[model samples]
Target chain A: MQYLFFLLAAISVITALVVVAAKSPINSVIALVLCFLSIAGHYILLNAQFLAMVHVIVYTGAILVLMLFVIMLLNMNTIVEVRKPVITRILAVVTGGLLFLVLLAATKQGLSVDVPTGFDPGVGLVKRIGMSLFQDFLLPFEVSSVLFLSAMVGAMMLAKKDGTENVNLPPSSEPDLRQAGPNDSAA
Target chain B: MENVMTAIRVVPLEHYLILSFLLFSIGMVGALVRRNIIIVIMCLELMLNSVNLLLVAFSAYHSDPGGQVMVFFIMLVAAAEVTVGLSILVLMKRNTDGVDMNILNRLKW
Candidate 1:
């Protein structure tokens, strides 16, 4: 189990680095997909087989594919010169480094973790999750459906183009819009 | 509980927490440094992934199923977040023909 976990962790870390480093957006997204897969592998090693599958299905399968499709649809392969000012970039790096260092310091010894040995890890199947969600979390469950519907409608509204803006074009006395009548009304 | 800590293996839990912390930091950096709206949204998802890892780890340590329920709720929210986030990104893309988030500053500046 240790070996399997280590292998998966190593894979996940390397792919995550690749996701950050790759210059192309498409490559970065692909690397991120790989990172998610390795994380799913860790889920399996942790004995959450159902979560492992759902993580892959929901995140890697659905979310990432949506990302990839968006990239392709946008055709954003062309160069987009990064616009961040140098000082801001430096500050951002420093802040990220500082935050990470603080987290590492606080969690350095991993805090005293205790789990009762020999306890059943419980059933983590989809059916079990569904039952709990529908039974105990029923109110929140129904609310989430309404939330999702609103999000979809909001997204559509954001993406849609509104028409019917009347434009008189200044009555176009310019040559391009001038009359094309013949005769000494010259050709 | 006291005796459990005595026999508990320290390595695995530390490792998982450290990895989650690292991923969360990376996501934070991505959010801070990237000027692309879509990429920023993706980074947010990464941050959420790190949170999910923390929840799962806690659930394992406590022998409780409630954290898993929270994880499911987060996924619900995440799915909604991404759908709206991406739609807005697409809208931004159409408006500007590119996704430089700095374009938003024009409204103010």
Candidate 2:
């Protein structure tokens, strides 16, 4: 069990580093998918089977694929990213290191807090989580549906062709008015 | 099921905390240093995942369903955020012909 935890931790850390360090966006995306998979493994190890499955589906399955599609659509797979200045990159690393140090120090003091509630292995099951979601968190669950709807609308508006460009043009112009026709009706 | 509990019990919770923190810092560094907007966005997702991992760890350790429920909400927000963010990325690419963050300096006064 300890070895499995170490293995998953190592995989997650390495893949996370690769996600940051890989030159190509595609490679980074692939590495990130691997990293998320490792995290799911960690979740399973931690006894959160439902969360583990959800993490795999929502993160590696959905979000990363969405990112990959966008990368491919933009043809960013071939374009090499320009490196930041060496000083800037070094400073970034230093800043992150400092943040990590601070976090470590903050957590170091509380390394062994007694668990207030006894461990329930079944707490992570889908049935338990579903009840919690539908009962205690019902309001947030409903509100999140609203959030999703708004996000869908917002994404469509933002990605629609000539959406922002039309907004910038004068409302009186003939071509602009014609172009805005479809958008207005759609809206 | 019994074996799963014993398996996780072998590892201390602090290790999970350290692992998630490391992942978060790596994401932060990537976001800071990367020039490509998409990669930066990916880094942001990485950070989010690290937090989710921590929350799940705590949830499991404390036997609290609330934490896992919170993770669900976080995922929901994250999904919505990514959709909007990527659409904006597509828009930026369409307008500028490149994904370089430096090109966004036009917004700076």
Maximum-TM-score candidate: 2
- Per-residue lDDT tens digits of candidate 1, residues B1-109? 3322221244457778888888888788778877877777777887898888777767656656667778878887998888888888887776666788888888895
Compose the digit string of candidate 2's lDDT tens values, residues B1-109.
7877875467778888899999999999999999999989999999999999999888888888999999989999999999999999998887777889999898897
Ten residues in a row with the worst lDDT in model 2 chain A? A163-172
Return the top candidate by DockQ. Answer: 2
TM-score of 2: 0.90
Over A60-107, each residue of candidate 2 has an lDDT whose tens digit, in order, gives 889999999999888887776788999999999999999999999999
Candidates 1 onward: DockQ, in order: 0.36, 0.69
Q: Cα lDDT for residue A169, model 2?
A: 43
For candidate 1, give the docking quality class from DockQ: acceptable
TM-score of each: 0.84, 0.90
